[model samples]
Target: MPNLSTTYLGVPLKSPLVVAASSISSHVDRVQMAESAGAGALVIRSLFEEQIQLDSMQLDEFLAAGSDSFSEATSFFPKIEHGGSKEHLMWVEKTRKAVSMPIFASLNAVSPGAWVTYAKQLARTGVNGLEVNLYSVPTDMGKSGSDIEKALYEVIESIKAEVALPVAVKLSPYYTSPANVIKQLEQHGAGAVVLFNRFLQPDIDPDTETLVNEMVLSNPAELRVPLRWAALLYGRTRLDLAVNTGVHTGRDAIKALLAGATVVQVASTLLQNGIPYLSTMLLDIQNWMDERGYKSLDDFRGKVSQKHCDDPFAFERAQYVKLLSSIH
Candidate 1:
């Protein structure tokens, strides 16, 4: 067997295949299964700002439901203040205790205050690191791309100021200049960046004339974007690159490593197939390494990236032009 141990966000992992944040973490058994199946790390599902707000609203409604019926009705309930984040925090702490593998907490928030506040709370959960899920759809026509990027930096800066844990930013792929953005994130104290947060776009049901907000899992074909970015950024920046969004198999993970990704975060494959499938993916990587006489992941990592590859232009537009020209 070959060595698969690697470090991600300064934390040592037994394998490079990490389990991405998803509903899989909602179940403690599934999380433990992932750890047993050879996942490098597990990012717990995000504590979304909306969830917190909704929880608070529900609590208020419960407290005021029959308060006006009588003076003692208000006193019938205890004056305990509750927030959804607290439940999520307890869950994270519990998950951290249940597994020995690195447990990463994820947060998705809009405002800088929310980011910093919850980031501080999550940091106290004894998790190995934090993954800031920067997931948002820009609906403001007046907001420039620079404006959005600035907000992201401000949120990250605020969180870094309040939290001491290693922070990894899960970035959206819609940025005009991704390399510069990753460089700026590193400058702002991000330890790693998960390439390309998959956006769940809503679809319209033509027959029913209704908008359908269904869950659509990612396919293997979605790996190209992050693979290209990883190859382009391999030797250019100090930030650890975690290729996300489309990794589905061991070959996909190998491609990510070849492109210099520090780790590959997977969620769709496990959800679609099964959690135990993680072991299969890891086995495939180990077998491939053994057959090639590669002793460790570092031996082949980034070997085909743009920085060291024989055909550098394969990752550039020249290759696309060549492919188009070769059509006849």
Candidate 2:
């Protein structure tokens, strides 16, 4: 068997396939199952700032109403139970004790101060690393791209200054210039970058005139966007790249490595196909490596990146030109 050990963000992983942040960590049994099944690492479910703020507002409203019945409403605030920065820290510490594998804590913050404060607290939890789930929808027409980018940088810098643990930023694909944003993030002390976090999009029901909020898992086709960006950014920056969003199989993970990704983070696939599927994925990668006569991940990783590939223009040039020319 070939060695599958690889390093991500300076932390050694048993393999390159990490279990992305999802409902898997909500229960201890699920997390242990993932490890036993062969996950390299695991990111705990994200603690969303929006959910915390909404709960706080509800608690305040209940208190102001001055109803004795409001006492029971306090349970609605998960932060008071398992969602606060301190509570999250404890959870990480507990999870670390439960499993020997590397565990990374995740946080979704809206403000720079909250980002810094929570990152510091999470660092004390004994996690191997931290993942910043940074996301914001630009609903205001007055805000320019520069303004949004500045906010992202400020948050990254604040968190970097406050914590000693390795930090990875999970970004949205809606940026006007993702390459520039990633370059700036690395300059500001980010250890790694997770390509493309899938956002929850709202849909409208025209017949019923209702709005719907759904949690749709990513499909395999979603891998192309990150693959192209990873190829273009490889050898250009120092930060490690972990591709997420649409990675569903061992072959998909191999495609990401060929595109210069340091590791592949998967969630939707494991959710769709039970946790044990991770073991099969790792086995498949090892078998492929053996057949190719590659003993280690570094032997073939990034061999097909834009900088390494013969047809560099294929990743950037418009495909329409080829289609139109061939039609004649």
Candidate 3:
């Protein structure tokens, strides 16, 4: 049997396959099942700052509407009990008590203050680490790329200064230079970088011509983006790389490791195949490692990375001009 143990964000994991933040953490039973199914670690469902802000605003509106009776009735059980930050903190505490595996609490905030504040609260939950789901869509015409990047760094720095737990940033791939962004995050004390958060894109309904929110699961092809970036940044940085988005099987996890990823996070696969499938993926990876005579993860990890590969130019290309000219 091969040793599948690995370390992520300085925390020891029994395996490199982690259950990414998804609907899995909604219940304690499911989280325990994932642990038994061979997941090294689990990221709890994210606490969205937008959700907290909306709840706060609604509570204030009710209080100011002269509905003293209603407000008094809801006072015993504050808005925090309904959908505020307190609920998430309580849930994290409960989950931590239920499992011995590393449980990382996730926070998705848009503002620097919100990020720092929530990070501190989450740290008090006794979680092993924190994952910052930096969910931002740069739609404003007045905002430049540098402006958006500055906001990201500020939030990271603020959280780092306030929290004691290890912090990992789940980044979006739409940046002009992802490597540069990762470097900036590391400088701000990020322990790990989760490559390419999958964004929910809106679709239009042909009949009504209205936009609809779609929840489409990622495909295996989506792994390529993170793979390339992970390979490109392998030897250049000291920060741990966590490949996410579209990872479906154990072989996919192996591919990520070969590209120099410290760990591979999977959500769509477990959701589609059920949590027990984690065991199967782990078995597949072990089998592959044994067949290749690789005793440990480091044996074959980064073997195919841009830094180790013969042709580094494949990772950095311009228009495929050479390939097109050769084809004709």
Top-lDDT candidate index: 1
Q: Which digits, one per residue and each the tens of the lDDT, describe model 2 over residues 1-328?
A: 8888889989999989889999988888889999999899999998777777887778667555654566765455444332456566777788888998999999998866888888887888899999999767888999899998888888888888778899999999889889999999998889999998888899998999999888899999999999988888888889999999899999999899989999999999999999999998998898889999989888887888888999888788736589779986
Model 2 bad stretches (over 4 Å): 66-83, 324-328
Tens-digit per-residue lDDT, 25-78, candidate 1: 999999999999999999999999998898888888877876877779887877
Q: Which digits, one per residue and each the tens of the lDDT, describe model 3 over residues 157-258?
A: 888888888999999999998889998888989999999799898999999999999799999999999999889989888888899997899989999999
Model 3, clash count? 0
Top TM-score hit = 1
Return the candidate ranking by lDDT, descending: 1, 3, 2
Cα shift from native, residue 246, model 1 (Å): 1.4
lDDT of 3: 0.90
Superior by lDDT: candidate 1 or candidate 3: 1
TM-score of each: 0.96, 0.92, 0.92
Off by over 4 Å in 1: 68-72, 326-328
Q: After best superposition, candidate 2 residue 80: deviation in angstroms?
A: 9.2
**Of the candidates numbered 2 and 3, which has the greater lDDT value?**
3
